[model samples]
Target: MSAAAVPEWLAAEVAALSGAARAGRLPHALLIHEAPGAGGDWLAHFAAQLALCERAAEAPCGSCTACRRVLAWQHPDLTRVAPLEDSRQIRIEQLRDLAAELALTSHAGGYKVGILTPATR
Candidate 1:
Protein backbone atom coordinates (compact mmCIF):
# COMPACT_ATOMS: atom_id res chain seq x y z
CA MET A 1 0.00 0.00 0.00
CA SER A 2 1.09 3.52 -0.67
CA ALA A 3 2.03 5.89 2.11
CA ALA A 4 -0.84 8.05 1.03
CA ALA A 5 -3.17 5.21 1.82
CA VAL A 6 -2.19 4.97 5.45
CA PRO A 7 -5.27 5.35 7.62
CA GLU A 8 -5.36 8.49 9.69
CA TRP A 9 -5.31 6.52 12.90
CA LEU A 10 -2.13 4.77 11.86
CA ALA A 11 -0.39 7.69 10.24
CA ALA A 12 1.41 8.65 13.40
CA GLU A 13 2.69 5.16 13.88
CA VAL A 14 3.90 4.94 10.31
CA ALA A 15 5.65 8.28 10.61
CA ALA A 16 7.35 7.26 13.84
CA LEU A 17 8.52 4.01 12.37
CA SER A 18 9.70 5.72 9.23
CA GLY A 19 11.67 8.20 11.26
CA ALA A 20 13.21 5.43 13.31
CA ALA A 21 14.19 3.55 10.22
CA ARG A 22 15.74 6.61 8.66
CA ALA A 23 17.69 7.27 11.81
CA GLY A 24 18.80 3.63 12.11
CA ARG A 25 17.28 3.52 15.56
CA LEU A 26 14.57 0.95 15.05
CA PRO A 27 14.12 -1.58 17.78
CA HIS A 28 15.07 -5.22 17.31
CA ALA A 29 11.45 -6.23 17.69
CA LEU A 30 8.08 -4.53 17.60
CA LEU A 31 4.77 -5.62 19.02
CA ILE A 32 1.81 -4.37 17.07
CA HIS A 33 -1.36 -4.94 19.01
CA GLU A 34 -4.64 -4.29 17.36
CA ALA A 35 -8.11 -5.72 17.16
CA PRO A 36 -8.98 -8.15 14.40
CA GLY A 37 -8.96 -6.55 10.93
CA ALA A 38 -7.33 -3.45 12.36
CA GLY A 39 -4.44 -3.53 9.91
CA GLY A 40 -1.88 -5.06 12.22
CA ASP A 41 -0.58 -7.32 9.47
CA TRP A 42 -0.31 -4.42 7.08
CA LEU A 43 1.74 -2.46 9.58
CA ALA A 44 4.00 -5.46 10.13
CA HIS A 45 4.75 -5.68 6.43
CA PHE A 46 5.31 -1.94 6.30
CA ALA A 47 7.85 -2.25 9.08
CA ALA A 48 9.65 -4.96 7.17
CA GLN A 49 9.66 -2.85 4.09
CA LEU A 50 11.00 0.06 6.07
CA ALA A 51 13.94 -2.07 7.14
CA LEU A 52 14.60 -3.76 3.81
CA CYS A 53 13.85 -1.02 1.33
CA GLU A 54 16.70 -0.33 -1.05
CA ARG A 55 16.30 3.45 -0.94
CA ALA A 56 17.18 4.38 2.59
CA ALA A 57 16.41 7.99 1.83
CA GLU A 58 12.86 7.09 0.91
CA ALA A 59 12.29 3.79 2.53
CA PRO A 60 9.15 1.79 2.00
CA CYS A 61 8.64 3.60 -1.24
CA GLY A 62 6.19 0.84 -1.99
CA SER A 63 7.44 0.77 -5.56
CA CYS A 64 11.08 -0.26 -5.34
CA THR A 65 12.10 -3.87 -6.06
CA ALA A 66 12.60 -4.65 -2.39
CA CYS A 67 9.22 -3.22 -1.49
CA ARG A 68 7.60 -5.12 -4.30
CA ARG A 69 9.22 -8.37 -3.29
CA VAL A 70 8.08 -7.90 0.26
CA LEU A 71 4.52 -7.17 -0.86
CA ALA A 72 4.59 -10.39 -2.87
CA TRP A 73 6.11 -12.36 0.01
CA GLN A 74 9.01 -13.41 -2.22
CA HIS A 75 11.94 -11.59 -0.62
CA PRO A 76 14.64 -14.07 0.40
CA ASP A 77 15.34 -12.05 3.53
CA LEU A 78 11.73 -12.04 4.65
CA THR A 79 10.36 -14.92 6.73
CA ARG A 80 6.70 -15.27 7.57
CA VAL A 81 5.47 -17.45 10.44
CA ALA A 82 1.93 -18.62 10.77
CA PRO A 83 -0.01 -21.63 11.91
CA LEU A 84 0.21 -24.65 9.64
CA GLU A 85 -2.85 -26.06 7.99
CA ASP A 86 -5.16 -27.95 10.35
CA SER A 87 -3.61 -26.16 13.29
CA ARG A 88 -5.21 -23.35 15.26
CA GLN A 89 -1.98 -22.17 16.82
CA ILE A 90 1.63 -21.94 15.84
CA ARG A 91 3.56 -25.00 17.01
CA ILE A 92 6.72 -24.79 19.08
CA GLU A 93 8.69 -26.32 16.26
CA GLN A 94 7.66 -23.50 13.98
CA LEU A 95 8.89 -20.90 16.45
CA ARG A 96 12.15 -22.77 16.86
CA ASP A 97 12.63 -22.94 13.13
CA LEU A 98 11.83 -19.27 12.82
CA ALA A 99 14.41 -18.45 15.44
CA ALA A 100 17.01 -20.50 13.62
CA GLU A 101 16.19 -18.85 10.34
CA LEU A 102 16.42 -15.38 11.87
CA ALA A 103 19.80 -16.24 13.31
CA LEU A 104 21.29 -16.82 9.86
CA THR A 105 22.92 -14.13 7.77
CA SER A 106 20.66 -12.10 5.54
CA HIS A 107 20.63 -13.15 1.91
CA ALA A 108 20.74 -9.51 0.79
CA GLY A 109 23.36 -8.51 3.34
CA GLY A 110 20.77 -6.22 4.91
CA TYR A 111 18.17 -6.50 7.60
CA LYS A 112 16.44 -9.86 8.00
CA VAL A 113 12.74 -9.55 8.63
CA GLY A 114 10.44 -12.07 10.30
CA ILE A 115 6.72 -11.50 10.53
CA LEU A 116 4.47 -13.56 12.76
CA THR A 117 0.88 -13.22 11.68
CA PRO A 118 -2.27 -14.00 13.58
CA ALA A 119 -0.12 -13.64 16.65
CA THR A 120 -3.24 -13.36 18.75
CA ARG A 121 -3.94 -16.97 18.06
Candidate 2:
Protein backbone atom coordinates (compact mmCIF):
# COMPACT_ATOMS: atom_id res chain seq x y z
CA MET A 1 0.00 0.00 0.00
CA SER A 2 1.07 3.55 -0.63
CA ALA A 3 1.76 6.04 2.13
CA ALA A 4 -1.50 7.77 1.32
CA ALA A 5 -3.31 4.58 2.14
CA VAL A 6 -2.06 4.56 5.68
CA PRO A 7 -4.98 4.97 8.09
CA GLU A 8 -5.60 8.31 9.71
CA TRP A 9 -5.50 6.86 13.21
CA LEU A 10 -1.88 5.93 12.62
CA ALA A 11 -0.80 9.28 11.23
CA ALA A 12 0.84 10.35 14.47
CA GLU A 13 2.79 7.14 14.75
CA VAL A 14 3.84 7.25 11.15
CA ALA A 15 4.87 10.83 11.49
CA ALA A 16 6.86 10.16 14.64
CA LEU A 17 8.72 7.29 13.08
CA SER A 18 9.30 8.95 9.75
CA GLY A 19 10.18 12.28 11.24
CA ALA A 20 12.70 10.72 13.59
CA ALA A 21 14.18 8.82 10.71
CA ARG A 22 14.52 11.92 8.59
CA ALA A 23 16.04 13.83 11.46
CA GLY A 24 18.44 10.95 12.22
CA ARG A 25 16.77 10.22 15.54
CA LEU A 26 15.13 6.97 14.55
CA PRO A 27 16.43 3.79 16.09
CA HIS A 28 17.96 0.97 14.08
CA ALA A 29 15.32 -1.43 15.32
CA LEU A 30 11.53 -1.13 15.66
CA LEU A 31 8.74 -3.27 16.95
CA ILE A 32 5.07 -3.08 15.87
CA HIS A 33 2.22 -4.71 17.73
CA GLU A 34 -1.47 -4.62 16.87
CA ALA A 35 -4.65 -6.60 16.90
CA PRO A 36 -6.20 -7.92 13.68
CA GLY A 37 -7.01 -5.26 11.06
CA ALA A 38 -5.25 -2.51 13.01
CA GLY A 39 -2.85 -1.77 10.14
CA GLY A 40 0.37 -2.91 11.78
CA ASP A 41 1.58 -4.52 8.57
CA TRP A 42 0.87 -1.39 6.60
CA LEU A 43 2.68 0.74 9.14
CA ALA A 44 5.73 -1.50 9.07
CA HIS A 45 5.97 -1.35 5.31
CA PHE A 46 5.43 2.40 5.24
CA ALA A 47 8.23 3.00 7.73
CA ALA A 48 10.58 0.71 5.84
CA GLN A 49 9.79 2.24 2.48
CA LEU A 50 10.19 5.73 3.86
CA ALA A 51 13.62 4.80 5.22
CA LEU A 52 14.76 3.52 1.84
CA CYS A 53 13.23 6.29 -0.24
CA GLU A 54 15.81 8.31 -2.14
CA ARG A 55 13.82 11.52 -2.44
CA ALA A 56 13.29 11.67 1.33
CA ALA A 57 9.95 13.35 1.04
CA GLU A 58 7.63 13.90 4.03
CA ALA A 59 6.13 10.59 3.11
CA PRO A 60 7.16 7.79 0.80
CA CYS A 61 6.64 8.74 -2.82
CA GLY A 62 4.89 5.73 -4.23
CA SER A 63 6.41 6.17 -7.69
CA CYS A 64 9.96 5.85 -6.46
CA THR A 65 11.92 2.65 -7.06
CA ALA A 66 12.27 1.85 -3.38
CA CYS A 67 8.61 2.52 -2.75
CA ARG A 68 7.54 0.32 -5.60
CA ARG A 69 9.77 -2.49 -4.49
CA VAL A 70 8.48 -2.29 -0.93
CA LEU A 71 4.80 -2.11 -1.95
CA ALA A 72 5.27 -5.05 -4.27
CA TRP A 73 7.27 -7.00 -1.72
CA GLN A 74 10.25 -7.30 -4.09
CA HIS A 75 12.78 -5.24 -2.16
CA PRO A 76 16.09 -7.01 -1.61
CA ASP A 77 16.74 -5.00 1.52
CA LEU A 78 13.41 -6.03 3.02
CA THR A 79 13.43 -9.63 4.20
CA ARG A 80 10.35 -11.46 5.51
CA VAL A 81 10.44 -14.32 8.02
CA ALA A 82 7.29 -16.29 8.58
CA PRO A 83 6.19 -19.63 9.97
CA LEU A 84 7.14 -22.78 8.09
CA GLU A 85 4.62 -24.31 5.71
CA ASP A 86 3.69 -27.33 7.81
CA SER A 87 4.51 -26.03 11.27
CA ARG A 88 2.30 -23.45 12.91
CA GLN A 89 5.46 -21.90 14.23
CA ILE A 90 8.56 -20.01 13.41
CA ARG A 91 11.52 -22.32 13.83
CA ILE A 92 14.99 -21.69 15.21
CA GLU A 93 16.37 -22.45 11.78
CA GLN A 94 14.34 -19.62 10.35
CA LEU A 95 15.66 -17.20 12.95
CA ARG A 96 19.17 -18.41 12.20
CA ASP A 97 18.66 -17.76 8.52
CA LEU A 98 17.39 -14.28 9.29
CA ALA A 99 20.42 -13.63 11.48
CA ALA A 100 22.69 -14.76 8.67
CA GLU A 101 20.89 -12.57 6.16
CA LEU A 102 21.03 -9.59 8.49
CA ALA A 103 24.79 -10.00 8.78
CA LEU A 104 25.18 -8.79 5.18
CA THR A 105 24.84 -5.27 3.90
CA SER A 106 21.76 -4.33 1.93
CA HIS A 107 22.03 -4.87 -1.80
CA ALA A 108 20.21 -1.60 -2.43
CA GLY A 109 22.61 0.39 -0.32
CA GLY A 110 19.78 1.12 2.13
CA TYR A 111 19.08 -0.21 5.60
CA LYS A 112 18.36 -3.92 5.74
CA VAL A 113 14.92 -4.55 7.21
CA GLY A 114 13.65 -7.85 8.53
CA ILE A 115 9.85 -8.28 8.84
CA LEU A 116 9.35 -11.17 11.18
CA THR A 117 6.00 -12.87 11.84
CA PRO A 118 5.90 -14.69 15.11
CA ALA A 119 4.15 -18.03 15.24
CA THR A 120 0.84 -18.19 17.08
CA ARG A 121 1.42 -21.75 18.03
- By TM-score, the best candidate is 1
What's the TM-score of every candidate structure? 0.95, 0.88
Highest lDDT against the true fold, candidate? 1
Q: Give the alpha-carbon lDDT of every model.
A: 0.89, 0.79
C-alpha displacement of 15 in model 2, angstroms? 1.0
Tens-place lDDT per residue, model 2, 18-46, is: 78987877678777778867888888888
Off by over 4 Å in 1: none
Global fold similarity of model 2 (TM-score): 0.88
Question: What C-alpha lDDT, on a 0 to 100 scale, does residue 68 get in candidate 2?
Answer: 87
**Runs in model 2 with CA error above 4 Å?**
1-3, 119-121
For model 1, residues 1-121, the per-residue Cα lDDT tens digits are 5777788888989999988987889889999999878889889989999999888888888889999999999999999999899998988899999899999999889999989877775
